[model samples]
Target chain A: DKKKQLQQLDNFIEGVLQEALEEFKQVE
Target chain B: MEERIFGTECEYALFHQLPPPSAQGSGKTAKWSGTSFSENLQEMSHLLVCALRGQNRPLAGEFLANGGRFYIDRGSHPEYATPECRSVADVIAHEKAGDRLVQKLVEEAGGLMAEKDIPGRLHAFKNNHDPRGNTYGSHENYLVSPRAMEKIQQIIPFLITRQIFAGAGKIPHLAPPAFSGEDWLPFAVSQRADFVEHVLSDRASDARGIINTRKREITRSGDNVRLHVILGDSNMSEYALKLKIGTTALVLRMIEDGLGDIPAFLQPVQALKVISRRPAGVHAVEGAGSGHTALEVQSIYLEKALGYFSSHAATGEEKAVLCLWETTLSGLKNLRISPSGVIEDDPGELSRKLDWVIKAWLLNRAREKKNLDWSDPHIKHLDFRYHDLDPETGLFERCASLGLVDRVIEEEAILLAMEAPPHNTRARLRGGIIGEAWGKDVEVLVENWESIRIIAKSKVDGMHPFARQRRSVNGLKANLNDPFEGCNEALLKRVRRFLDKCDEV
Candidate 1:
């Protein structure tokens, strides 16, 4: 369960960063 | 006696793909492909860890350091989590240390990136949201007992309204297509508000709640409840950060004592978003089985806190927090009643203390100066620039230099905090071990906040977060559990002996 939670958090962070990076590229 | 320890975990993105100053000087803006940027960031993370290792900095579980931990988090962004702090002042100091450390890493890596012709200078922002409606976190962690965890629902009202003073103000941009024209606000009190979608949830990423329930406690002690708050804005103003944490601590104390008189908001998630969008207006939010404005709800908490302080002995820090809270509430009330929607009598006073006020003042002035509407892209850029970690270019630093914003922590304190842990709590012990291990060249394993193993000697267990103890193989034990103890000479001596024994073996 702990591993799953950590994995979820990792994925969430990656999603946020990926979306931001993509948006940043478009705007810049 | 055990004391509550507060800490912060700040996640920030590095824009390494942008053109470096050297590249821009050549009259060309160079950009790295996203793939290359990710690869180079991974390489830089390794180099950063190596650099810290070279300095003999004790690393825990590969990434955690003495003062804090640094690693490449998800999406290749670097995250820093400060060691446990005893006070809100310590929280601010350690958080600033992170900003400095990251800036140092960027500057150091800039040379290497230049050598590799990576083309872009890395920039980090401490703010919460990006321009594309995505938000990251500057999550606050507070150590509490299991008993205090029961009072979380009671504290939600206070959290919902605190953004009036605590929010790192953001310009509204890119309203969702589902929203009608009137739903688009000109500005918001919080940068993280629009992204919040839950009233209470264990999940942090998809449906982020005001108070997170992801149950990973850094301290192994069974008694502590780690209160992870993911709702707040990433504040640049020291005063805002201090008040935000300090006032919440005081309120938690009140709730634990059963002295809380908090109202229940009807739709807390919607109320949170509304409060951030319409900070100055008195909107009806159902609370206390009736309708109340955010200011009114905040006033109730402030009054209860004041009453609590009056009945019980309040510390100097608590007193200062109460004074600031009262002053901020008054400022909000005054702004609501004012015809001009500006504090003309002492515009600079609140601007110097509150994050949202300061930012709103700056944005309003810029809007007037540039003859641009609030929806201008440049306004959003200015908002992001307010949180730039660079002292030379960050708008908040410029405001501080101009005496438009106030600071609680001293510069020297922040610099000291970068290397040294807080004097109180188990962090000092952790930091001492790291320092000694580095000095003696003894290989040790740092597991977490509570456990450290001396290589081939013994495992030092600091089970109680507040209790500092030293145990040896020969049954020579010393107790230094008191949080107020300034020096850990006895423990340091024991650690040195253990390192020597390990080396001899």
Candidate 2:
């Protein structure tokens, strides 16, 4: 249960960060 | 005697985060399961102790109970205990050097946790040290003074509202005209949206949306420093719990020890006042999105929102709270608001009702203090119902805004007096009430009213007439709601005389 949760959290963070980075790049 | 934690003082830091949901699996790589938040805290404490003492495996957990001396950079970065480069430059140079060290530690720890597939992303931050991550850390110190607590009470509200004008509404919109098709607060969508999204994910999983309301993780050794890393929802509720009331309470306790006047800069942003208690030299990193590399855009915005308050002013009563509130609200506005004037819409009227109770308490106090009558048109028009109060509470978020906290404290005094002395700490009582659903039971009574009178009498004796006046007024509470709002001037005068009598004693 813990492992599944951690992996899901990592993927979620990666996705959000990737999206934010993309937004920042576009603004520049 | 077991020893007293009442008068000892220490330095400390705090960090709050909204890590992504998917990182929970990273715990698999960790030697221990980082399932529960407390468990993770225990695990990290053990790891840091090991690193600090140069132990191969974990040492006896009793090191925490004993007065062990070892620094800790709480969160996921334990490797910063040893940075590559040694010599330091300016404060920023020192910060950066620490960051360099933490970066390596963060990766190593993350890698180790990942190997075990832990169910959370680890975000760590230390006050004096720099971090490998984006931006989210607080540094603070507590000076042992017989006067620290009193000074805190004098300055709480003024500090939270300090940075009013500059911090708010920075980002115009979430995206360009392409997405929302409207301009919003500058960087609002970038920072807050990301935070909200993170909250929605697995990292915020443990809190069930109650993350922001948790009080400080208190630690005391005479005059002690309490620290916590909270990932609260972006709202006044979060601000109240995380910074306003709790910090004010702690600082007031300090002022009683003769800390005297506070520093000028620290006065405006008092809400951001957090003291981190580590073994001294440990380094940590802070930030939400992305890993160790330094990014200018992310760093600048993060600093503007979170870092600015911690670094802005070192003194003053009103200045500290103001600056802290300004920065906090600016960051909050970035996060979207719920229809019920909170972050989530799940609990419906329950949340709305609680918010109303808080707001009404504030309004009543303000009206009394300002000499405004209850029948005034402004008071009449102002909505006191939970539904209306929810949206109305937003007015407390602006520059020079007196958030609905002081009034709450006054109401709390009434509640405390009613529940009078020789009881558990206020935190324990509030915790039981909020967390346990207990009632106005005698078990929570203020058992030490004699002690309280002793404290109050010793401190308040020949001072202001206002203190005497208040004491007299409070002495007339015959019933639970006897001194409630709208009792008329005749009642107030009577209560005032009664309170004065109490004060005389």
Q: Which numbered prediction scores highest in lDDT against the true structure? A: 1
Residue range B163-244, candidate 2, lDDT tens digits: 1211111122123453221221112211111222211122322322101223332333344333222221112232232243
- Clash totals for all models, in order? 1, 124
Which docking band does candidate 2 fall into?
incorrect
TM-score of each model, paired residue for residue: 0.82, 0.24
The Cα RMSD in angstroms, rounded to one decimal, for candidate 1 relative to the true structure is 9.5
Per-residue CA lDDT of model 1 for A1-28, tens digit only, reads 5466434433432332232324333443
Q: Fraction of true contacts kept, per model? A: 0.06, 0.00
> Candidate 1: TM-score?
0.82
Deviating ranges (above 4 Å) for candidate 2: A1-28, B1-102, B110-139, B162-184, B188-505
Model 1 lDDT tens row, B1-505: 1256788988775645453344354533334544223345666665555555555555655434444777777656677888878877888899888888887777677676677665655667787766655567889988776777876788888899889888987766654454333323456778888888987779877799998888774654556678899999888889889889998898888877785456677788888887776664444554344477777888889889878777888878888889988887887666531222233554336777877777767666565655656565556556676777766556676666655567887899998888888887777876677676664434556655555665533443334221143333322223333333437777777667666654444
The TM-score between candidate 2 and the true structure equals 0.24
Tell me the lDDT of model 2 at B73: 40
- Top-DockQ structure, candidate number: 1
